[model samples]
Target: MSPRSCWIGSALAVVALAGCNNVSNEMVKMPPPAVTVAQPVEREIVHQLEFTGNTRATEAVDVRARVNGYLQKIDFEDGADVQAGDVLFVIEPAPFEAALDAAKAAQQKAEATLALANADLARTQPLVQRGASTEQELDVKKADVATAAADVASAKAALTQAELNLSYTQVKSPISGRVSRHMVDIGNLVQAEQTTLTRVEAFDPIHAYFAISESDVVELMAKSPGTSAASLKANPPTIYVGLTGEKGYPHEGKLDFAEAGIDPQSGTQMRRGIFPNADKLLVPGMFVRVRLPVGSPAPGLMVPDRAIGMDQSGEYVLVVNEKDTVERRSVKLGLRVNGMRVVNEGLEVGEWIVINGLQRARPGAPVKPERTTEIVEAKQLDASNDPAIANSGAQLSTTTPAKASATGGN
Candidate 1:
């Protein structure tokens, strides 16, 4: 019985030892995990401050009736483009015409009186010298001439005023722009200097206004030494603008104006940009996206966003060395430009970064890194979802420069 038991135990121990040897051989023969790696892309990137703004016409005018009269005719259709001096409304010009004719007649009569006064003065002067007329009579004639001359001048001034009033009857646009609908319909009486006829707004070369925070302004000033609000206005920086539903900032402009001081209540400074609206794409009272580059373009390194990972130590990336060893690198990241994450520090250009199979990579362990030449195309930065910009709270909107009056007639 003892011999049988010992033999059975010996056979079991041998089987266990053989199983352990097989497991060890399998572990040693297993290959390293394959991972996709790419070198960090170097690009020229500019840090831009973004904001929401509103567009307004460069020149806006509220056209009004200068003379009191009934609106006889509307020469333009609603929302028509008009040039300066284009007749928009005829405000009972017939009455003004009659008044002008009467003034012309009065002016002619005054001129005749003036001519007669001069003839009389000439005749009296000769008579006074020849002693044909007494001194007192000559003086009386001179007084009569002076009085007639004054009356003629008064009549002439009246004539000029009448002509001006007549011209005012034909309401003309004072600026070249798109006109709003007429405020007063035909046969409606409009008061002089009080009636708002319509509005005209210049579209080409439009204005876009946005507000920037005082903190951001201070940062900008620090970046550019010796730069002040006045200097910014005098030598404007390039700006980009985009309307709602538009991709990127297609319109280019200049930061033409900046407020002298930041508003204490809002802690922001008003800034204005002027853009060419030759295509008529930009309209007043439209919400737009604006971008202003902070400093000159600088070189930066970027990697795919998926390649980055966060931990208790903050953001880190899996980098592969020349020996195919994986290393965990703590990196300082900036804004996301395009779709790539900007590596501000702790990463170098041309260093291989794990793009795929990150979970399979372990620090200080060997990996089969598959090198990839693919890179993200460096283009315009979309700051809409950038956490850096969102944290700064730079996206803000302000009131439009000019509001169209609802009561004005087009």
Candidate 2:
């Protein structure tokens, strides 16, 4: 009886131990962590290149005195709008008037001398023909007449020069534009073609200059050969200029010119646009942003910033597979518009991605997805939802576990 009882008890104990081990293993096996997944969304995307540039007036001019004299009057007010040929200053004309009078008197005296010489020549010709005067006398009288005619021509030229000088006494603007402050005020002596009296800047149809990368120029030219630098003057590209802190483009401009060669130092091509500043709002040396349409818009895919993850390798996003499992996906990015990113590759539309609870998520782990809006509501309901974590999770921050998983998965 004792041998039979001992054997049965040992066998039962061994079976029970084996059963307990199986139960322990079963209890330790836990399901994958719950994660929310999202689908790759489809939307229209626009590719754009944003660059910082400056505004400049298309043309600028400086007004100066052509003749030297004391400025008797200022015809234009400082900072006043003026037209081409508008009087800007008036120099003292007294000296110029005296010169004109002297030139006219000299001209009249020369004319009188020419008339007397002609009379003498005529009289000598008759005498020579009648044999009353020597041929040498006739020749001398004819020479006198020719000299008098030359004197008359010289006097006439002097008179014309005097008139021109007199006209120059009233300094007129060379171009239509806004007149700057007078460099030389009234009663100040200015030199001829040497001293700059003031400046006149053309505001209407002003110019804006900007630079584009050499690569961009090459791409653009490849797409449209007609838009090369050589043909820019005849058929220039259109440009739009917008001021900082302003809404839309205030002025539309046309490409006027481009540099013949790329700038070696910057590796950029300089381009110019002409804009109409009829309102006088645009000025030279003003900083402005320029927009140029280089290519046609194409349809593409995009995702929110929260879905992208970045690490040493590059940018990527989390993709939920058909089995409702998370898989890290490496992506090629194109442009950033608003807060969204253009997905150049590595993602297809309508694929789910984990957007929330990413801090606790890992690659290939099972996820329990809640709508993004639901997550927001839950965070609002539970004050303990650490807004920072919720926001980070919402944004799929790279430092978070889900982002690490994406990086690891990649």
Candidate 3:
């Protein structure tokens, strides 16, 4: 090797060694992650299950024509409230009146004939006993009397039928309710037992029908052993109902009816609830929200839904320990009351849980946690989450019982 090149390489190695010695290994401390935390709320809570249902009338009646006649008059206004036995329509009474009169005349004639025949039989009996008439003649006279008596009875029945037809000419509301519009106008020919003049539905008490899944039914039956859907029909459970667009269940009702069995097509069992609608606020066929209590009141712990998290292990929540270190806790969950998810296990009532900035939390890491009495501040879905699932269950339920409803029975 050339002496100049060896000297240059040696100089470069000495410089690199000096640079390496000058550098020192040191670790920079990163700041603890800032987060919000809250203690869980403990309360005696029962599972409130809500289901979509439809309102029904307690008693719905289709006022139909009872006798064939021309509609003569409409006595009640369309959609007016009516009492039981209130006249709503008037068919032409002329024909029925004439028929009834004819029947009465025929009955009178039969009565006169029966009286004459009775006198003749009395005379024949005396004559037969005294041998003033032949036995065959007396027998013939007795038969005549019997025939006349039968005619009189038949005529009386005809008269009663005629009177009934005349009475039916004035059609009356058979139920107390708001009447529907007239189906047939004045002078329209209506057939007996064939035409529906209008309809009436009882309004004081309304009904709501709903369905529940088989799993829910099983859970409910387990909580109250020996309870069956049929037994519930006899003595209903407490329930609540709400109309569409209502914020919460505003109407109270009772669960009175349940289908004999579950519907195979939908895997749900039909149930019914009855609500007092004295104010006439409820209508038939309206969609309603029904809420039912699945379990008796028991102590339970709840946390903000946002604080709950999921991982390969299962659902978890970040809890802050005494040292304010973030700890991942696996928890068993119950039904959501609203925004709050009930923690059945793995969480204590007083434990601090991370309510916000979950991304910043990691197990065993120290964190800057701000504690507040308000456990779950109502929160919306974050933008980074998948849109489809991001909006799902974002808000936490405020502290309240879950709303529910069901059907009604007699």
lDDT for each candidate structure: 0.80, 0.72, 0.80
* lDDT (tens digit, per residue) of candidate 3 on 104-148: 999999999999998998888888898889999988888888999
List the RMSD of every prediction in angstroms.
Answer: 14.1, 11.4, 11.0
User: What shift in Å separates residue 2 of candidate 2 from its native position after superposition?
Assistant: 49
Clash number by candidate, in order: 7, 12, 14
lDDT of 1 by residue, 191-299 (tens): 9989899999997999999999998899778775323567865677778887787656778888888888999999999889999888898999999998877776666
Residue 348 accuracy (lDDT) in model 2: 73
Q: What's the lDDT for candidate 1?
A: 0.80
- Taking all chains together, each candidate's TM-score versus the true structure is 0.72, 0.72, 0.76
lDDT of 2 by residue, 158-258 (tens): 99999999999999998888888989878778899888989888867877788889888887787655557788777776667778776445467787788
Cα shift from native, residue 362, model 3 (Å): 7.0
Ten-residue stretch with the least lDDT total in model 1: 401-410
